[model samples]
Target: MNRILVIGGTGTVGRQVVSRLAATGARVRAMARNPGAARLPPQVEVVRGDLTLPETLDGCLDGIDAVFLVWTAPATAVAPALERITKHARRIVFLSAPLKTPHPLFQQPNPLRAMVEHIERLIETSGLQWTFLRPGMFAANALNWWAPQIRAGDVMRWPYLAAPTTPIDERDIAAVAVRALYEDGHDGAGYVLTGPQSLGQFEQVSAIGRVIGRSLRIEEISPDEAQRELLRIGPLVAVNMLLNAWAAAIGQPAHVTSTVAAITGAPAKTFLDWATDNAAEFRA
Candidate 1:
């Protein structure tokens, strides 16, 4: 059995990866900044590790054969962390954004993209077998974007409601990542993963409303208003990035891919599937 370490194992996608790996009867170790707070299964060994503090990763990487890296640390810490990971893990699967894709949606200025590219270069030259999972818009973003609005009422006020996106489910990303981590032939491969359908922002909201049995109202606001209101939820850069991406996506169809089905032998979950699975979050 491969002893796998999942860095950033407490995040939305990372948590799914950890659970999926554990279900496969693999020796799974989860690295978190706070081990006691990690609400994982009893079988998973949780270790305290912080990417900002590279010294903390030494213990977490011990005897770890393969690693699933979800980097949330600053770009300054990438070099030191990769050095430590390379010493222990022979293979690594990094959760990254679609930086290489030529689509305007992905080409928009994102602060995270520079950091990911830098990390990718380091991993490529580090001599460890590496695979990059570049995922598009996450379907789970609805939780943060509209769950509160839905939980309170039916009106979802937003900007660029006509913008199209694939809204890939995070589980599909994890499933592809799991195969890359333990399996062969995935080394040096970069998988561009997305949901199967190209649905507009309003259509996605309608899908959620249909799944939850509600006739929700989607009020389109200007980008300026959205920036102002969304700032309360995320950082300035993240808010601007989303607004910019959605604004650019309005006149074009979102880039969709079949990599999930190609790799996992099953189609990626639709936005409706995601909404149905998490309908409770939108309930009052």
Candidate 2:
């Protein structure tokens, strides 16, 4: 693809995708509601657009050969947005969750998954060459959910400490996505991406502690307590979905995949690596 548009380009994975694509000298445009604050690479064209407003996307897709779509809003506008996208872009690479993956981690029925399934169906019939990057739990979530606790004390209190997950690095996810956007033979593909190894929540916490030179403790709490805490911080439906998924994944290791290595020609990064890279977030 010669020219690419990155929806949600200001986001974690989308920013990295923009950087990678721009590095290769592709004409890149990042669609954001506030282009002034997107702070993308100087070479990346930041366009004012909102996915919730389908009419705003009309000009954003112009002259774009491919699109790196990271759906951030609800699915209400997906059909209209896809209609606009297919009109201009020849290909699309979506950052999506592993909805069809049979692992317990993904098997749970959740509103997020339902929305993703609906979007996937629309993309399938949109006639644009498409690729779905179905990533598992993101390692970056540690910063959002646990950084405050780790920065404050030695004890990491959480629920379902035994739940195993292969947390893929956002950078790795972006690397694979860049390939799918510009490379051939990736259309009509759904790639399940994960980190190199399956690590329990306790183990992941320990990994962070090791990087920061602290011996942290994991205090498992009741699911109800966890639910109450999550309710205070996030939506109830999402909180419950996570609680149920973790409960189901207590003994089951997350499904690991070689797709990242297959596409990027490098082994998937480890949790230790992710912790070390983001060690400052966990430092006391």
Candidate 3:
């Protein structure tokens, strides 16, 4: 009769986590800002709540044994939300990025990183069992960057042609998150998860080519050009973060970790495999 509450449940990773947990016959409640918009399974209890307003989560946490907490709000609200979950849940599984190096972009007072780290610190002293999953760049991010180009045809322009990364499948991150939320022995642990191989931007795009049966061309543009294009497409904060990360990765070693396979008892899927599975999304 154990129930779990999932925050940001309508998001990419959260959807997968909710589905996996529901399949096990566990009572799952999905928290979202717009419950009506969440395309969750019939068994899931989709509740309307916002992380910025912790007061609204009042009855949502009732009788919930554990929480899959994704940092969705600014740093100022993290403590209150954690406290609310702590009042009812015995454990929590947090999704966060690995800390950046040199300047530590994560430590620069940014809301997301500050809140994530603060929550980890709070859980450490709150006597709540916890697990943190710090996965690398998501292969789904390629869908954000390259899917449109693939649909348009032949060419994908990108920066960091030589900057390789072990892009993890979001599903693997969810699998680990689901296990950590319901199981034991993962408490107080941080997992650095990544895909099976380190691939540069061109190689990643080419993998998409093989999957969808198209000869996708790689247009190697400068980081400056990439920045301009990204800014034109979206918000400034995300674009700057991505450009800086790519610049750092150009010279640094690509992070490849066995934590996913180690925790799941199965090898992490490759980028080619990920592209193949999601080929329909990239099709025109």
Candidate 4:
């Protein structure tokens, strides 16, 4: 059995990865700051770890063959963490940000960009195999942002109701990550994964409505209103980051890619498909 370590294993994508890997009988370890709260399967070894301190990973890397690395913080310590992993692991699947763009968010002045670039450089020269999975907006994010409103009523009020996106399913993203971690073909590859089609936020809300047998009304609000409402309910930093990203995508279409289908041997899931799959999460 191959031993794999998943960082950020308590997150939306990481939870799915750990679940899928455990179901398939892989020897998996989930590393996070709060391992006891991760709720991983009994088969998985949950270890307390932090990205900021790579030395804490020493005992956890014993016999670890591969890693699925996801950054939860500003990524200031990624290089050190990679150094620790490269010492033991043969392959690494890194969850990449859309910071591949040239905007200020991805520029040299950005701490996240610097961290991502540093890790990429280190992995490229480490003589170890690497794959980078860069996924667009997650369909799961809709649940986090809009599910409460959908559950409360049949009306969804949000900004960018017409903003288009190829919202990839986090489960599909994890599936590809697992393949890259365990398989042989993805070495030195960076995949831009997206959903099967570009759908606007309104369309996505409507899809969820259709899945749950309701007709939902989408009311588009001003960006200022959205920001104010978000700050009141959402995590301050994350909400601000998303507001910035949406501002950047005001007119430009979100990039849609074939990489998910190409790597997974199946068309990327539609938002409707995803909504149907997670219908229970949207119930009133």
Candidate 5:
């Protein structure tokens, strides 16, 4: 029995990964600062650990064969955490963005991309088997960015209405991660995951509208206004990166890949599918 450790097991994709791994009857352990708050499967052994504090990772890695790592913190702790992981785990499957892809969507250099690239370099030289899962925009962003406005009324205001993206479902991303964690031949491979079709931000909202039985309208706003609103909610660097990526992606089709089906033996879910599944979020 292989002991698998999942960092950020309580998060979006990480939670699904933990569930999938547990369903396979694998010995799964989840590391979180607050293990008590993590609503994981009864079989999973929840352990208290913080990635920022390298000393807390000491016992968590003890007997783990492979790790599903989701870097949820700053880049400052990445090096030390990687050092600890390399010393223990034989393999690691990392959840990262598609920074190396030449598509306009990923071409914009950001702090997150820089941090991931640095971690990738460290993992490469660590002599450990590593698989990188680089996924594009998440379909769940609709819930975060537009759900509030959708629930309040039939009109949603946002920037980059023409900016296209293949919003990959978090479940699909998790399935691929699970395969890379347990299977062979994925070592040193970087997988670029995306949704099945390219849809613009307006089309995305329309999909949500159809799912919720509403005639929704999208009002495009200025990028500068979007930046200011985003800055109020998130860091300036992340907001700028998003603004730049959307600006670059305008009038261009999003980069779609068959890597999900190639690896997981299933087609990637479309944005409409995601919208339909999460329709309740858009409903009052």
Candidate 6:
């Protein structure tokens, strides 16, 4: 693919993909609702596009050979948005979850999962080459769940401390995505990506504290209390889905995979490595 477009370019993983592709001297374009404030690499073009508004995608997909799609729009927009994408781009790399994995953590039914399944079905039948990157718990999620508490105090309170997850770094996810977008032999691939090892929520928090040079205490709270506190930052659906998944994940080792290292030819980053790199985000 000579030229590529990245939807959701301003997002955490999307920005990493944009930066990596631009550094490789690939012709890259990023789609944002507000292109003026996208703040991506200056060498790449930033265009205004919205998945919900299908008409806005035409200009973004113009003359593009492939796309990196990080979809967060409503379910109502899935069909329409893909319709526009198929008209221009022949290949797409979708940021998806491990829907088919036998692990109980991902087997739970949720609104988000249902929508992703629908999107996948549509893409599979649309006659376009597609690659799905199904990543597990993201290491960046720690910044959302514990950053404020760690920045303010020494004690972080959370439930399901024993529940484990293989937290993949966003950089690794983006690296594989870039390869899928540009390289051959990746079409029809469904990669279940994860970190090198499993770590519990408490262990992840402690890792962050270690990186920031603090001996932070982790307090276990009840599920109800945790839900209330978390709802302040996330929607009810997402919050409940996480609580249910974590509760189901107890007493089970998380599912880890070597797909990231296999695809990128480098060892998958550990949770400690992610914490060390993002240590400043947790500092006061």
Q: Which stretch of 10 consecutive residues in model 1 shows the poorest summed lDDT?
A: 108-117
In candidate 3, list every pair of residues with a backbone clash. Answer: none
Alpha carbon lDDT at 191, candidate 6: 100
Clashes per candidate (backbone, < 3 Å): 0, 0, 0, 0, 0, 0
Candidate 5 regions exceeding 4 Å error are none
**TM per candidate:** 0.98, 0.97, 0.92, 0.88, 0.97, 0.99
**CA lDDT, every model vs. true structure:** 0.92, 0.90, 0.83, 0.82, 0.90, 0.94
Off by over 4 Å in 2: none
Instruction: List residue ranges in candidate 6 displaced over 4 A.
Output: none
Model 5 per-residue lDDT tens digits across residues 38-116 = 9999999999999999999979999999999999698999999999999999999999889889988899877888888
Clashing pairs in 1: none
Model 3 residue 40 lDDT? 95
Superposed on all Cα atoms, the candidates' RMSDs to the truth, in angstroms, are 0.9, 1.2, 2.3, 2.8, 1.1, 0.8
Model 2 Cα lDDT, one tens digit per residue, 24-104: 888899999999999998988999998889989989998889999999697788888888999998899999899888888
Which scores greater on lDDT, model 2 or model 4?
Answer: 2
- For model 6, the local distance difference test gives 0.94
Off by over 4 Å in 1: none
What digit string (tens of lDDT, one per residue) describes model 1 on residues 186-276?
9889999999899999999999889889999999999989989998668888899999888888888899999999999999998889988
Of candidates 3 and 1, the better by TM-score: 1
Choose the strongest candidate by lDDT: 6
lDDT of 6 at 173: 97
Summing lDDT over every window of 10 consecutive residues in candidate 6, give the lowest-scoring window. Answer: 225-234
lDDT of 4 by residue, 46-154 (tens): 9988878888987778789998988766566767877899999998898986556543322223444566777778888988889988887899987778898989998
